[model samples]
Target: MADTLQAGDAAPDFKLPRDGEGFLTLADFKGKKLVLYFYPKDDTSGCTAEAIAFNGLTGDFAAAGTAIVGASPDPVKKHDKFRQKYELSFPLLADESKQMLEAYGVWVEKSMYGRKYMGVERTTFLIGADGRVARTWRKVKVPGHAEEVLAAARQL
Candidate 1:
Protein backbone atom coordinates (compact mmCIF):
# COMPACT_ATOMS: atom_id res chain seq x y z
CA MET A 1 0.00 0.00 0.00
CA ALA A 2 1.17 3.54 -0.73
CA ASP A 3 1.33 6.32 1.80
CA THR A 4 -2.06 7.95 2.21
CA LEU A 5 -2.15 11.60 1.21
CA GLN A 6 -3.04 14.11 3.89
CA ALA A 7 -4.84 17.39 3.78
CA GLY A 8 -2.75 20.28 2.39
CA ASP A 9 -0.72 17.94 0.20
CA ALA A 10 -0.76 18.49 -3.54
CA ALA A 11 -3.47 16.39 -5.20
CA PRO A 12 -2.08 13.98 -7.75
CA ASP A 13 -2.70 14.60 -11.42
CA PHE A 14 -4.30 11.86 -13.47
CA LYS A 15 -5.64 11.34 -16.99
CA LEU A 16 -8.49 8.84 -17.11
CA PRO A 17 -11.30 8.13 -19.54
CA ARG A 18 -14.71 9.63 -18.93
CA ASP A 19 -17.86 7.57 -19.40
CA GLY A 20 -18.00 6.63 -23.07
CA GLU A 21 -15.87 9.56 -24.06
CA GLY A 22 -12.44 11.11 -24.07
CA PHE A 23 -10.12 11.57 -21.11
CA LEU A 24 -10.34 13.94 -18.17
CA THR A 25 -7.39 15.24 -16.21
CA LEU A 26 -6.97 16.99 -12.89
CA ALA A 27 -5.80 20.06 -14.73
CA ASP A 28 -9.15 20.20 -16.49
CA PHE A 29 -10.63 21.59 -13.26
CA LYS A 30 -7.64 23.59 -12.08
CA GLY A 31 -9.61 26.73 -11.29
CA LYS A 32 -12.43 25.00 -9.48
CA LYS A 33 -12.80 23.10 -6.24
CA LEU A 34 -13.19 19.37 -6.87
CA VAL A 35 -15.00 16.64 -4.99
CA LEU A 36 -13.16 13.51 -6.12
CA TYR A 37 -14.61 10.29 -4.76
CA PHE A 38 -13.46 6.69 -5.16
CA TYR A 39 -15.72 3.69 -4.90
CA PRO A 40 -15.42 -0.07 -5.31
CA LYS A 41 -17.80 -0.70 -8.21
CA ASP A 42 -20.78 0.46 -10.19
CA ASP A 43 -24.38 -0.62 -9.32
CA THR A 44 -23.34 -1.99 -5.93
CA SER A 45 -25.50 -0.98 -2.96
CA GLY A 46 -23.15 1.35 -1.11
CA CYS A 47 -21.71 2.78 -4.29
CA THR A 48 -25.15 3.41 -5.74
CA ALA A 49 -26.37 5.22 -2.66
CA GLU A 50 -23.28 7.40 -2.54
CA ALA A 51 -23.53 8.30 -6.20
CA ILE A 52 -27.25 9.02 -5.95
CA ALA A 53 -26.75 11.26 -2.93
CA PHE A 54 -24.18 13.26 -4.79
CA ASN A 55 -26.33 13.30 -7.89
CA GLY A 56 -29.25 14.70 -5.90
CA LEU A 57 -27.04 17.49 -4.62
CA THR A 58 -25.40 18.29 -7.93
CA GLY A 59 -26.84 21.74 -8.10
CA ASP A 60 -25.79 22.60 -4.55
CA PHE A 61 -22.26 21.52 -5.33
CA ALA A 62 -22.34 23.61 -8.44
CA ALA A 63 -23.64 26.59 -6.51
CA ALA A 64 -20.65 26.21 -4.21
CA GLY A 65 -18.35 26.25 -7.24
CA THR A 66 -17.32 22.66 -6.68
CA ALA A 67 -17.36 19.99 -9.36
CA ILE A 68 -18.08 16.39 -8.42
CA VAL A 69 -16.27 13.49 -10.03
CA GLY A 70 -16.34 9.81 -9.17
CA ALA A 71 -13.69 7.19 -9.98
CA SER A 72 -13.71 3.42 -10.05
CA PRO A 73 -11.81 0.58 -11.66
CA ASP A 74 -14.83 -0.24 -13.82
CA PRO A 75 -14.64 0.40 -17.56
CA VAL A 76 -16.18 3.36 -19.37
CA LYS A 77 -18.99 1.13 -20.55
CA LYS A 78 -19.98 0.31 -16.98
CA HIS A 79 -19.67 3.93 -15.99
CA ASP A 80 -21.98 4.95 -18.82
CA LYS A 81 -24.64 2.52 -17.71
CA PHE A 82 -24.26 3.46 -14.06
CA ARG A 83 -24.61 7.15 -14.80
CA GLN A 84 -27.62 6.61 -16.99
CA LYS A 85 -29.23 4.42 -14.36
CA TYR A 86 -28.72 6.89 -11.56
CA GLU A 87 -29.10 10.02 -13.63
CA LEU A 88 -25.82 11.26 -12.23
CA SER A 89 -25.01 14.71 -13.49
CA PHE A 90 -21.28 14.44 -12.92
CA PRO A 91 -18.57 12.63 -14.79
CA LEU A 92 -17.49 9.20 -13.66
CA LEU A 93 -13.87 8.59 -14.55
CA ALA A 94 -13.00 5.06 -15.62
CA ASP A 95 -9.87 3.91 -13.81
CA GLU A 96 -9.71 0.46 -15.33
CA SER A 97 -6.03 0.06 -14.45
CA LYS A 98 -6.57 1.21 -10.84
CA GLN A 99 -4.04 3.98 -11.41
CA MET A 100 -6.05 6.77 -9.84
CA LEU A 101 -7.38 4.48 -7.12
CA GLU A 102 -3.89 3.51 -6.00
CA ALA A 103 -2.67 7.08 -6.19
CA TYR A 104 -5.51 8.20 -3.96
CA GLY A 105 -4.88 5.30 -1.54
CA VAL A 106 -8.44 4.05 -1.87
CA TRP A 107 -7.44 0.73 -3.41
CA VAL A 108 -6.81 -1.58 -0.48
CA GLU A 109 -6.88 -5.07 0.91
CA LYS A 110 -10.48 -5.76 1.83
CA SER A 111 -11.87 -8.79 3.59
CA MET A 112 -15.38 -10.11 3.10
CA TYR A 113 -16.82 -13.41 4.31
CA GLY A 114 -13.25 -14.38 5.31
CA ARG A 115 -12.06 -13.79 1.77
CA LYS A 116 -9.41 -11.20 1.08
CA TYR A 117 -9.40 -9.04 -2.05
CA MET A 118 -8.27 -5.66 -3.21
CA GLY A 119 -10.78 -2.92 -3.94
CA VAL A 120 -11.67 0.71 -3.37
CA GLU A 121 -12.21 1.77 0.27
CA ARG A 122 -15.03 4.21 -0.33
CA THR A 123 -13.03 7.39 0.01
CA THR A 124 -13.55 11.01 -0.87
CA PHE A 125 -11.21 13.98 -1.23
CA LEU A 126 -12.09 17.63 -1.28
CA ILE A 127 -9.51 19.41 -3.38
CA GLY A 128 -9.14 23.16 -3.29
CA ALA A 129 -8.90 25.41 -6.30
CA ASP A 130 -5.10 25.44 -5.96
CA GLY A 131 -4.97 21.63 -6.40
CA ARG A 132 -4.17 20.82 -2.80
CA VAL A 133 -6.21 18.34 -0.83
CA ALA A 134 -8.39 20.23 1.60
CA ARG A 135 -10.06 17.26 3.29
CA THR A 136 -10.11 13.48 2.98
CA TRP A 137 -12.58 10.91 4.27
CA ARG A 138 -11.41 7.31 4.40
CA LYS A 139 -13.84 4.44 4.85
CA VAL A 140 -16.67 6.77 4.06
CA LYS A 141 -20.28 6.08 4.99
CA VAL A 142 -22.80 7.05 2.32
CA PRO A 143 -25.46 8.66 4.49
CA GLY A 144 -25.24 12.46 4.55
CA HIS A 145 -21.65 12.32 3.28
CA ALA A 146 -22.26 14.62 0.36
CA GLU A 147 -23.73 17.23 2.66
CA GLU A 148 -20.64 17.06 4.83
CA VAL A 149 -18.48 17.52 1.74
CA LEU A 150 -20.55 20.49 0.68
CA ALA A 151 -20.08 22.08 4.10
CA ALA A 152 -16.36 21.54 3.86
CA ALA A 153 -16.27 22.98 0.36
CA ARG A 154 -18.05 26.08 1.55
CA GLN A 155 -15.28 26.65 4.05
CA LEU A 156 -12.58 26.38 1.41
Candidate 2:
Protein backbone atom coordinates (compact mmCIF):
# COMPACT_ATOMS: atom_id res chain seq x y z
CA MET A 1 0.00 0.00 0.00
CA ALA A 2 1.12 3.55 -0.60
CA ASP A 3 2.22 5.35 2.53
CA THR A 4 -0.89 6.12 4.56
CA LEU A 5 -1.53 9.84 4.73
CA GLN A 6 -1.29 11.68 8.02
CA ALA A 7 -1.82 15.10 9.48
CA GLY A 8 0.45 17.66 7.76
CA ASP A 9 0.59 15.54 4.59
CA ALA A 10 -0.82 17.12 1.45
CA ALA A 11 -4.15 15.67 0.43
CA PRO A 12 -4.01 13.88 -2.89
CA ASP A 13 -5.88 15.37 -5.81
CA PHE A 14 -8.55 13.51 -7.76
CA LYS A 15 -11.20 14.02 -10.42
CA LEU A 16 -14.07 11.57 -10.03
CA PRO A 17 -17.57 11.21 -11.41
CA ARG A 18 -20.27 12.24 -8.97
CA ASP A 19 -23.89 11.11 -8.62
CA GLY A 20 -25.40 13.83 -10.76
CA GLU A 21 -23.06 13.39 -13.74
CA GLY A 22 -20.17 15.72 -13.05
CA PHE A 23 -16.67 15.49 -11.68
CA LEU A 24 -15.38 16.40 -8.22
CA THR A 25 -11.79 17.15 -7.39
CA LEU A 26 -9.78 18.33 -4.46
CA ALA A 27 -9.52 21.69 -6.15
CA ASP A 28 -13.31 21.93 -6.15
CA PHE A 29 -13.12 22.17 -2.39
CA LYS A 30 -10.29 24.66 -2.34
CA GLY A 31 -10.58 27.28 0.41
CA LYS A 32 -12.92 25.05 2.40
CA LYS A 33 -12.44 22.17 4.79
CA LEU A 34 -13.51 18.77 3.48
CA VAL A 35 -14.83 15.58 4.96
CA LEU A 36 -13.94 12.85 2.50
CA TYR A 37 -15.19 9.37 3.33
CA PHE A 38 -14.67 6.05 1.58
CA TYR A 39 -16.99 3.10 1.80
CA PRO A 40 -17.01 -0.34 0.17
CA LYS A 41 -20.43 -0.27 -1.49
CA ASP A 42 -23.42 1.89 -2.20
CA ASP A 43 -26.41 0.32 -0.47
CA THR A 44 -24.99 -1.87 2.25
CA SER A 45 -26.28 -1.44 5.80
CA GLY A 46 -23.26 0.31 7.19
CA CYS A 47 -22.81 2.43 4.11
CA THR A 48 -26.42 3.49 4.09
CA ALA A 49 -26.39 4.41 7.71
CA GLU A 50 -23.21 6.39 7.35
CA ALA A 51 -24.58 8.27 4.37
CA ILE A 52 -27.75 9.10 6.23
CA ALA A 53 -25.82 10.29 9.22
CA PHE A 54 -23.77 12.62 7.12
CA ASN A 55 -26.81 13.83 5.24
CA GLY A 56 -28.54 14.62 8.50
CA LEU A 57 -25.73 16.96 9.38
CA THR A 58 -25.26 18.68 6.05
CA GLY A 59 -26.34 22.03 7.41
CA ASP A 60 -24.01 21.78 10.39
CA PHE A 61 -21.06 20.90 8.17
CA ALA A 62 -21.87 23.74 5.83
CA ALA A 63 -22.08 26.10 8.74
CA ALA A 64 -18.51 25.13 9.56
CA GLY A 65 -17.39 25.65 5.94
CA THR A 66 -16.77 21.97 5.46
CA ALA A 67 -17.95 20.02 2.45
CA ILE A 68 -18.90 16.38 2.86
CA VAL A 69 -18.18 13.88 0.10
CA GLY A 70 -18.46 10.12 -0.09
CA ALA A 71 -16.57 7.85 -2.47
CA SER A 72 -17.17 4.23 -3.43
CA PRO A 73 -16.33 1.82 -6.22
CA ASP A 74 -19.94 1.88 -7.38
CA PRO A 75 -20.76 3.72 -10.58
CA VAL A 76 -22.65 6.97 -10.84
CA LYS A 77 -25.95 5.18 -11.55
CA LYS A 78 -25.83 3.26 -8.31
CA HIS A 79 -24.73 6.34 -6.48
CA ASP A 80 -27.73 8.21 -7.80
CA LYS A 81 -30.12 5.54 -6.66
CA PHE A 82 -28.54 5.35 -3.25
CA ARG A 83 -28.60 9.09 -2.83
CA GLN A 84 -32.19 9.38 -3.92
CA LYS A 85 -33.25 6.54 -1.69
CA TYR A 86 -31.67 8.19 1.29
CA GLU A 87 -32.20 11.79 0.20
CA LEU A 88 -28.51 12.28 0.72
CA SER A 89 -27.51 15.91 0.41
CA PHE A 90 -23.80 15.47 -0.31
CA PRO A 91 -22.11 14.34 -3.47
CA LEU A 92 -21.24 10.69 -3.83
CA LEU A 93 -18.09 10.24 -5.88
CA ALA A 94 -17.74 7.28 -8.21
CA ASP A 95 -14.27 5.82 -8.08
CA GLU A 96 -14.94 2.96 -10.44
CA SER A 97 -11.27 2.43 -11.30
CA LYS A 98 -10.30 2.50 -7.62
CA GLN A 99 -7.54 4.97 -8.40
CA MET A 100 -8.48 7.39 -5.65
CA LEU A 101 -9.01 4.53 -3.25
CA GLU A 102 -5.50 3.24 -3.75
CA ALA A 103 -4.01 6.69 -3.51
CA TYR A 104 -5.77 7.22 -0.20
CA GLY A 105 -4.66 3.78 1.04
CA VAL A 106 -8.26 2.85 1.76
CA TRP A 107 -8.23 -0.16 -0.56
CA VAL A 108 -6.94 -3.09 1.42
CA GLU A 109 -7.15 -6.81 2.06
CA LYS A 110 -10.07 -7.42 4.40
CA SER A 111 -10.97 -10.64 6.17
CA MET A 112 -14.46 -11.78 7.04
CA TYR A 113 -15.84 -15.23 7.77
CA GLY A 114 -12.27 -16.51 7.46
CA ARG A 115 -12.11 -15.28 3.88
CA LYS A 116 -9.76 -12.57 2.72
CA TYR A 117 -10.60 -10.15 -0.04
CA MET A 118 -9.77 -6.72 -1.32
CA GLY A 119 -12.15 -3.94 -0.26
CA VAL A 120 -12.41 -0.43 1.08
CA GLU A 121 -11.34 -0.10 4.70
CA ARG A 122 -14.18 2.25 5.73
CA THR A 123 -12.02 5.29 6.24
CA THR A 124 -12.58 9.03 6.56
CA PHE A 125 -10.23 11.95 6.12
CA LEU A 126 -10.64 15.49 7.41
CA ILE A 127 -8.78 17.77 5.03
CA GLY A 128 -8.21 21.38 5.90
CA ALA A 129 -8.74 24.23 3.46
CA ASP A 130 -5.06 24.31 2.49
CA GLY A 131 -5.26 20.71 1.15
CA ARG A 132 -3.36 19.15 4.01
CA VAL A 133 -4.82 16.23 5.90
CA ALA A 134 -6.02 17.35 9.31
CA ARG A 135 -7.03 13.96 10.63
CA THR A 136 -7.89 10.44 9.49
CA TRP A 137 -10.09 7.70 10.84
CA ARG A 138 -9.64 4.13 9.61
CA LYS A 139 -11.72 1.03 10.28
CA VAL A 140 -14.53 3.47 10.97
CA LYS A 141 -17.59 2.38 12.86
CA VAL A 142 -20.74 3.74 11.24
CA PRO A 143 -22.71 4.63 14.34
CA GLY A 144 -22.08 8.20 15.47
CA HIS A 145 -19.25 8.52 12.97
CA ALA A 146 -20.57 11.60 11.25
CA GLU A 147 -20.88 13.33 14.59
CA GLU A 148 -17.29 12.47 15.40
CA VAL A 149 -16.12 13.76 12.05
CA LEU A 150 -18.06 16.97 12.57
CA ALA A 151 -16.40 17.46 15.93
CA ALA A 152 -12.99 17.07 14.35
CA ALA A 153 -13.85 19.35 11.43
CA ARG A 154 -15.02 22.01 13.86
CA GLN A 155 -11.58 21.95 15.41
CA LEU A 156 -9.98 22.52 12.02
Candidate 3:
Protein backbone atom coordinates (compact mmCIF):
# COMPACT_ATOMS: atom_id res chain seq x y z
CA MET A 1 0.00 0.00 0.00
CA ALA A 2 1.15 3.56 -0.57
CA ASP A 3 2.00 5.75 2.39
CA THR A 4 -0.82 7.80 3.76
CA LEU A 5 -1.09 11.22 2.19
CA GLN A 6 -0.10 14.31 4.16
CA ALA A 7 -0.93 17.98 3.96
CA GLY A 8 1.62 18.79 1.28
CA ASP A 9 1.11 15.84 -1.06
CA ALA A 10 -0.53 16.39 -4.38
CA ALA A 11 -4.12 15.19 -4.31
CA PRO A 12 -4.82 12.29 -6.62
CA ASP A 13 -6.84 12.96 -9.73
CA PHE A 14 -10.17 11.22 -10.28
CA LYS A 15 -13.12 11.29 -12.64
CA LEU A 16 -16.14 9.30 -11.54
CA PRO A 17 -19.85 9.07 -12.15
CA ARG A 18 -21.91 11.14 -9.73
CA ASP A 19 -25.46 11.14 -8.46
CA GLY A 20 -26.52 14.03 -10.67
CA GLU A 21 -26.02 12.21 -13.95
CA GLY A 22 -22.66 13.84 -14.65
CA PHE A 23 -18.99 13.25 -14.11
CA LEU A 24 -16.68 15.26 -11.81
CA THR A 25 -12.95 15.31 -11.78
CA LEU A 26 -10.14 16.80 -9.72
CA ALA A 27 -9.52 19.44 -12.37
CA ASP A 28 -13.10 20.65 -11.99
CA PHE A 29 -12.10 22.17 -8.65
CA LYS A 30 -8.69 23.36 -9.75
CA GLY A 31 -9.08 26.93 -8.49
CA LYS A 32 -11.06 26.17 -5.36
CA LYS A 33 -10.76 24.17 -2.21
CA LEU A 34 -12.48 20.79 -2.13
CA VAL A 35 -13.69 18.52 0.60
CA LEU A 36 -13.45 14.97 -0.69
CA TYR A 37 -14.87 12.54 1.81
CA PHE A 38 -14.79 8.78 1.42
CA TYR A 39 -17.18 6.62 3.30
CA PRO A 40 -18.01 2.91 3.39
CA LYS A 41 -21.59 2.87 2.26
CA ASP A 42 -24.72 4.91 1.65
CA ASP A 43 -27.78 5.41 3.92
CA THR A 44 -26.04 4.06 6.98
CA SER A 45 -26.40 6.13 10.14
CA GLY A 46 -22.96 7.68 10.24
CA CYS A 47 -22.79 8.21 6.53
CA THR A 48 -26.24 9.75 6.50
CA ALA A 49 -25.40 12.18 9.25
CA GLU A 50 -22.17 13.17 7.61
CA ALA A 51 -23.87 13.80 4.28
CA ILE A 52 -26.64 15.82 5.89
CA ALA A 53 -24.17 17.89 7.86
CA PHE A 54 -22.24 18.79 4.75
CA ASN A 55 -25.44 19.38 2.86
CA GLY A 56 -26.63 21.79 5.51
CA LEU A 57 -23.44 23.78 5.13
CA THR A 58 -23.54 24.15 1.36
CA GLY A 59 -24.02 27.89 1.53
CA ASP A 60 -21.29 28.30 4.11
CA PHE A 61 -18.91 26.17 2.07
CA ALA A 62 -19.72 28.08 -1.10
CA ALA A 63 -19.00 31.34 0.71
CA ALA A 64 -15.56 29.95 1.48
CA GLY A 65 -15.17 28.94 -2.16
CA THR A 66 -15.05 25.28 -1.34
CA ALA A 67 -16.85 22.39 -2.98
CA ILE A 68 -17.88 19.21 -1.20
CA VAL A 69 -18.10 15.75 -2.73
CA GLY A 70 -18.59 12.34 -1.25
CA ALA A 71 -17.39 9.01 -2.62
CA SER A 72 -18.08 5.35 -1.99
CA PRO A 73 -17.79 2.03 -3.80
CA ASP A 74 -21.52 1.88 -4.07
CA PRO A 75 -22.97 2.04 -7.57
CA VAL A 76 -24.51 5.13 -9.15
CA LYS A 77 -28.04 3.82 -8.56
CA LYS A 78 -27.32 3.62 -4.86
CA HIS A 79 -25.86 7.10 -4.80
CA ASP A 80 -28.90 8.54 -6.50
CA LYS A 81 -31.29 6.99 -4.03
CA PHE A 82 -29.22 8.01 -1.07
CA ARG A 83 -29.00 11.61 -2.28
CA GLN A 84 -32.67 11.86 -3.04
CA LYS A 85 -33.61 10.29 0.26
CA TYR A 86 -31.67 12.81 2.26
CA GLU A 87 -32.03 15.72 -0.10
CA LEU A 88 -28.26 15.98 -0.18
CA SER A 89 -26.95 19.30 -1.49
CA PHE A 90 -23.75 18.03 -3.04
CA PRO A 91 -22.79 15.35 -5.49
CA LEU A 92 -21.87 11.86 -4.33
CA LEU A 93 -19.48 10.12 -6.65
CA ALA A 94 -19.87 6.41 -7.28
CA ASP A 95 -16.58 4.57 -7.26
CA GLU A 96 -17.84 1.12 -8.06
CA SER A 97 -14.40 -0.13 -8.99
CA LYS A 98 -12.74 1.29 -5.86
CA GLN A 99 -9.93 2.85 -7.88
CA MET A 100 -10.44 6.32 -6.45
CA LEU A 101 -10.76 4.95 -2.92
CA GLU A 102 -7.58 2.96 -3.29
CA ALA A 103 -5.70 5.90 -4.81
CA TYR A 104 -6.72 8.03 -1.84
CA GLY A 105 -5.50 5.26 0.49
CA VAL A 106 -8.82 4.81 2.21
CA TRP A 107 -9.57 1.30 0.98
CA VAL A 108 -7.96 -1.10 3.41
CA GLU A 109 -8.29 -4.03 5.72
CA LYS A 110 -10.73 -3.39 8.52
CA SER A 111 -11.54 -5.31 11.68
CA MET A 112 -15.00 -5.57 13.04
CA TYR A 113 -15.87 -7.87 15.96
CA GLY A 114 -12.47 -9.49 15.69
CA ARG A 115 -12.83 -10.38 12.03
CA LYS A 116 -10.77 -8.67 9.37
CA TYR A 117 -12.08 -7.59 6.00
CA MET A 118 -11.50 -4.92 3.41
CA GLY A 119 -13.62 -1.82 3.41
CA VAL A 120 -13.54 1.89 2.89
CA GLU A 121 -12.24 3.89 5.80
CA ARG A 122 -14.05 7.00 6.81
CA THR A 123 -11.62 9.66 5.64
CA THR A 124 -11.69 13.21 4.39
CA PHE A 125 -9.20 15.19 2.38
CA LEU A 126 -9.08 18.94 2.06
CA ILE A 127 -7.44 19.74 -1.25
CA GLY A 128 -6.25 23.28 -1.77
CA ALA A 129 -6.65 25.25 -4.98
CA ASP A 130 -3.08 24.33 -5.88
CA GLY A 131 -4.09 20.65 -6.10
CA ARG A 132 -2.21 19.73 -2.95
CA VAL A 133 -3.79 18.35 0.12
CA ALA A 134 -4.21 21.01 2.81
CA ARG A 135 -5.50 18.68 5.51
CA THR A 136 -6.64 15.10 6.11
CA TRP A 137 -8.79 13.37 8.67
CA ARG A 138 -8.47 9.63 9.02
CA LYS A 139 -10.79 7.33 10.93
CA VAL A 140 -13.19 10.23 10.94
CA LYS A 141 -15.76 10.81 13.59
CA VAL A 142 -18.72 12.39 11.84
CA PRO A 143 -19.96 14.88 14.40
CA GLY A 144 -18.98 18.48 13.73
CA HIS A 145 -16.68 17.35 10.93
CA ALA A 146 -18.27 19.47 8.24
CA GLU A 147 -17.98 22.57 10.43
CA GLU A 148 -14.34 21.81 11.06
CA VAL A 149 -13.60 21.43 7.37
CA LEU A 150 -15.50 24.64 6.69
CA ALA A 151 -13.40 26.49 9.25
CA ALA A 152 -10.26 25.24 7.56
CA ALA A 153 -11.50 26.25 4.13
CA ARG A 154 -12.34 29.71 5.42
CA GLN A 155 -8.79 29.94 6.69
CA LEU A 156 -7.51 28.91 3.28
lDDT per model vs. reference: 0.93, 0.94, 0.93
Q: Could you tell me the TM-score of candidate 1?
A: 0.97
Per-residue lDDT over 1-156 for candidate 2, one digit per residue giving the tens place of the 0 to 100 score: 354688889998999999988899999999999999999999999999999999999999999999999999999999999999999989999998999999999989999999999999999999999999999999999999999999998888
What TM-score would you give candidate 2 relative to the actual structure?
0.97
Q: For residues 43-131, could you state the per-residue lDDT of candidate 3 as single tens digits?
A: 99999999999999999999999999999999999999999999998999999898999899999999989999999999999999999
The residue-level lDDT of candidate 3 at 48 comes to: 92
Task: Candidate 3: list runs displaced more than 4 Å.
Answer: none
Residue 9, candidate 1: Cα error in Å is: 0.5
Clashing pairs in 2: none
- The model with the greatest lDDT is 2
1-156 per-residue lDDT for model 1 (tens digits): 244699989999999999969999999999999999999899999999999999989898999999999999999999999999888899999998988888888889999999999988999999999999999999998998999999999889
Q: How good is model 3 by TM-score?
A: 0.97
